[model samples]
Target: GAGVSQTPSNKVTEKGKYVELRCDPISGHTALYWYRQSLGQGPEFLIYFQGTGAADDSGLPNDRFFAVRPEGSVSTLKIQRTERGDSAVYLCASSVQGARRTEAFFGQGTRLTVV
Candidate 1:
């Protein structure tokens, strides 16, 4: 890990509980992503792996959201019941592989608070 590496950061579950957000990318990148910010705007992709499949995931926003990246560097973002508008701030990015336009590496989020 030398860049993207999200973890606890700040999470407060309640409304239904069931959250698992984690992303550790940077050792090789390969194009991993998952975004969601809600206090103002921007960042709202949701899913997009490239090595372990999930080319897009259509910006997950239903079925309680879901994401994964088996061995493509590490990635996981599952949120079941939880509500309260599903508090936001859960980003994670990476690059290299196909570059998606270049410039990625971003991991300083994971602020879910669905009390």
Candidate 2:
């Protein structure tokens, strides 16, 4: 795809259910990121993947959240035991891995509603 693509733009899951959000980054981009945004807050970094390995995952809230980029191209965020507080927009972004100044391109985001 020309730009970041996220599947299931909108998702509604019941509490205690599990959900998986997919992200297809721009072609050739090696730096991929996953973030979550609540109502009025800015996107909170969840994890960052450089190529096929996760470079940084410090922002992941707990063991229930995880992200992976097995092929260095597409990524997926997995959530377990979804809670009401987990309802938010999950955003995916990508940029050149080591360019001096590469701007990240973001997807429209997947709005996950946990009810």
Best by TM-score: 2
Output the lDDT of residue 71, model 2: 85
Tens-place lDDT per residue, model 1, 8-106, is: 899999998899999898987788888899998988887888888888888888988888888888889999999999898999988887554788878
Task: For each candidate, give its TM-score against the true structure.
Answer: 0.32, 0.96
Backbone clash numbers for all candidates listed: 0, 0
* lDDT of model 1 at position 29: 74
Q: Please provide, for model 2 over 2-113, each residue's C-alpha lDDT reduced to its tens digit, 9 standing for 90 to 100.
A: 8999998999999999999999999999999999999999999999898999888999999999888898998999999999999999999999873547798999999999
Stretches off by above 4 angstroms in model 1 are 1-14, 17-30, 33-48, 55-65, 68-78, 83-91, 98-104
In angstroms, give how far residue 18 of model 1 lies from its true place: 8.9
Task: Specify the poorest-scoring 10-residue window by lDDT in model 1.
Answer: 96-105
Q: What is the overall TM-score of model 1 with all chains considered together?
A: 0.32
Instruction: Pick out the ten consecutive residues of candidate 2 with the lowest summed lDDT.
Output: 96-105
How does model 2 score by TM-score?
Answer: 0.96
